[model samples]
Target: MKKVIEKKVYNTETATLIAEYWNGLGEDDFMYCEEYLYRTRKGSYFLRGSGGPLTKYSESNENQTWGISTIIPISKEEAYEWLEANDKTEAIEEYFSNDIDEA
Candidate 1:
């Protein structure tokens, strides 16, 4: 399965959209995706997931310091596509199987 990396939002509306999308997928189908909510300085939010690269690029970038505040199960493909459509290419990468949890 292809994975999308990350998404950043500054408001609740976007966060709601993410939640809605996850809920729409149905619980039985959630194994295909993973979603996480992160907070940076000043309350900024980040929505990220596992799938692509084994190496987390953010660990080498400024976002390495960002704190993950929550985690949820969502469609990995959907998140990846959204990132691609929105031109968030920097959020996508190749990841190793061991880096992700099978759950």
Candidate 2:
């Protein structure tokens, strides 16, 4: 079984991680995806998604064939939906809470 990873990560592309749903550390799949939820200092919520394929299908396939990508400002509704689909209760509460945070 793949080991579960629980650690903090800093991605300057988006905001820092407030609640890490999937770290994708010990995954051995061909395509691995990681989801991290963050809240800016102004209380704005954002989900930082980052991932890529583990191996290339061809030797000359370095032209970005796969659709692996990371979107910076994922919609609040979409973020909530993702959280709910993943069953992140604690993150769900913190996501809609009145507390402030820093990215």
Candidate 3:
């Protein structure tokens, strides 16, 4: 028989914040971070296969796997706070700096 691995990868505080943002999901709501790698940012996480904002699917044509999505706590001082709180990972080079770009 194959072993069923547990899917909770987050530390207590991060997990608690995520739970608050996306409440009502059950234990099996979705896969965990360790199931696949993820990039955690100030207000959201970008999964491997994300196709930017315009496309729902990932940009890679050869890839078959759909990208994952995650919720993040929203606040005005989010980016600064996030860097201070978490490990100092690589700096994000590109991001939408304007609200109009989202549409």
Candidate 4:
């Protein structure tokens, strides 16, 4: 199934932070797409919101980074709808919540 990703991200710096964090750790388990940033762990994964076409970077002499030309063109409402339809928020919450038995 086509992954439904959120439109609203926590901050504009999130993408950069993620890229930098991954770079710092020297990992290559993430893929940047027009919809969302996909990170895989043990063959499973999750998506996070980020600038789509506008979230790329050019080749730089200082550090190697992704070149996000644009972000996923969407709004907050659309993002929420996608989340609800995919039931991702619930799954994520259930996974992270302290009250695992309650859920």
Candidate 1 C-alpha lDDT tens digits along 1-103: 1122365334433343322122233333323234444333443334554321222211235543321223333345545555555544344443113333444
lDDT of 2 by residue, 1-103 (tens): 1111234333434454556655455445546567667654554555555454653221226574442434355556766776778888687777656443445
**Candidate 4: global Cα-lDDT?**
0.35
| TM-score of model number 1 | 0.23
Choose the strongest candidate by lDDT.
2
Model 2, CA-based lDDT: 0.53
> In model 4, which runs have C-alpha deviations exceeding 4 angstroms?
1-34, 37-70, 91-103
Instruction: Write the number of the candidate with greater TM-score, choosing between 1 and 2.
Output: 2
Q: Report lDDT per candidate.
A: 0.36, 0.53, 0.29, 0.35
**Model 2 TM-score (2 dp):** 0.52
RMSD of each: 15.9, 10.3, 13.8, 12.9
* lDDT at residue 22 of model 1 (Cα atoms): 29
TM-score for each candidate, following the candidate numbering? 0.23, 0.52, 0.20, 0.24
Residue 93 of model 3: what lDDT?
Answer: 17
- Residue 93, candidate 4: C-alpha displacement in angstroms: 6.4
Q: Better model by lDDT, 2 or 4?
A: 2
